[model samples]
Target: MADVYDTTYGQADYFGSEASPLLARYADWIPAEARVLDIGAGQGRNSLPLARRGCRVTALEPSGVGRAAIKAQAAEAGLDLDIVGENFMSYEPRGVFDVILCFGLVQILRYQECASLVTRLHQWLRSGGTLFLTAWHVGDPSFARLTREWERLGIRSFRSPDGSQYRLFLEDGEILKLFFRWQTIHHCEGLGPEHRHGDGPPERHGEIEVVLTRP
Candidate 1:
């Protein structure tokens, strides 16, 4: 059974116009026809399109709500996708994929677990495979305040079904350093407090986008 945190799936759209930019950048590195793994996938936003384009897609979402959303959207789009409601720290890939996405996942665990996950994700990729990641940057003042509030509320350390706590924030160098074993293709530090469709952006929630490839 999923925990309280699991219910918060698909809360916000992290990527709006930037989705195209990330996809285009990924296309340049990943093969035209590739198997993609969307770790922490929510609602099949990016996964659905990739599957529609003829790529084999496997979305790994730990949240039941998130996984159900993936399936729901996949059917709505008529996109074939394999859904696995498994935690990232314990998720063993069936095989290496051409592209692996870790978007909006780094801050979802402890600092050490996050580090191990990056290394494991890199290992799960096939040679020349690409890994894309985006996370809320810790430098954002608004997010800092939010984290403090969540902590103050005594939910600072809520446990998930997988025994992991949820608090998402990452440093710039820590994110950039994930490419130590892989070659970096693209990296961006676009500050946004959650803006989609000219929503004029919010006051908090900025993210950093990263794309790296295994050699």
Candidate 2:
């Protein structure tokens, strides 16, 4: 995975310097001094902004390059960001966080892995803490291509166009089902323009954006 990101991060601006609009939109849900865990926090896109907002952020990333970029950006901004170079699956939470960011990661894991990860995340959040997530859904136009490949291979995972990466796409209600034990604050799934990672043409995707609070 590190090798994959090392190449991707080097080739394209997948993790932008600025915070994503999704994160910014829900920033108020996080208190001024809240503790935040940013899983798959590549290059501090969300971490830096949350830190600037007075949140103490712990950024967990798998790639060394990504972690280095995040550290450098945090330093340039003179912000204190706890950047951890580790995969989230093997990472042990030190303490409960007031808010957890899991953007653009759920769709990459196997079905069971996604289930287990969310279950662990539920335990990692404090009562009433928020978990924000974004993932590709079956409604996206890309879903048809991925589904065809999955059916051909008889597996849930689909390889990237270059065959260097594999990702999973969820269907309707999957996200809600995963967090059925929690209180859903917001959930939306529909067609949306894909993030332009590199100078590629803008494409449409079936995507799901969700915010849930642990009870």
Candidate 3:
């Protein structure tokens, strides 16, 4: 999986350079010196922007290529970011964070792994900390296609024919169940903005977006 992303990051802008719009949508809640953890922080898209805002950011990316890009960009911009070239499973966090960003991550894991990560998130966040997450859901247009072409691993999990890709699409409000104790700051589900990747034509995902805060 790491190699796959390393190749992708080396070859193209798999995820565009722009930061996620969620940042602007919830800017008031994140302080300038807030400690941030950007899980799966691919190529520093969100990490760089948060750092530029004077937030203390820890960008975790398993792909070496992605980490290098982040380091280069941060150095060029004279920003100091804590870049971790470790996947979530192997990396152990040192302290609690004021904010955690999980973008384009959940779908790649199985149900149990995703749930486990959610448990860890609760423990890793400071009281009143915020979490921003996004994932593809079962209602996605691609889900039907993937169900037909791929091997079903679970109720919502699928593996591609070549076995190079795996996905676990969420059920509507499925993630909310995991964080039921938290306060919901924002929640939306449906098709996401159009995007193009690696010579592929424009496409949009059936995405679930949520922002929550621990009590």
Question: Which one is best on TM-score?
Answer: 3
Clashes of each: 1, 1, 0
How should the candidates be ordered by lDDT, best one leading? 3, 2, 1
Compose the digit string of candidate 2's lDDT tens values, residues 1-215.
45567766774347566687787888888898999999998777888888998999999989888888888877888999899888777899889999999988877776667778877888899999999999987776866777655432324457665666667777788888878778887888988866677566777778899889988
After the best TM-score superposition of candidate 2, give how far the Cα of residue 185 lies from its true spot, in angstroms: 2.0
Q: How far is candidate 3 from the true structure (C-alpha RMSD, Å)?
A: 1.4
What candidate 2 gets wrong by more than 4 Å, as runs, is 150-156, 159-164
Which tens-of-lDDT digit does each residue in 38-135 have in candidate 3?
Answer: 99998888899889999999999988999999999999999999999887877789999999999999998877788788888988899899999999
Better of 2 and 3 by TM-score: 3
Candidates 1 and 3 compared: the better one by lDDT is: 3
After superposition, which runs of candidate 3 have C-alpha atoms over 4 Å from their true positions?
none
lDDT by residue for model 1 over 12-119, one digit each (tens)? 343441344577655656555799998877656777778877889899877677677678777887878999888778888878888888776776666667768877
What are the lDDT figures for the candidates, one per model?
0.69, 0.81, 0.89
In candidate 1, list every pair of residues with a backbone clash.
107-168
Q: By TM-score, how accurate is candidate 3? A: 0.95
Better of 1 and 2 by lDDT: 2
Give the lDDT of residue 93 in candidate 3: 90
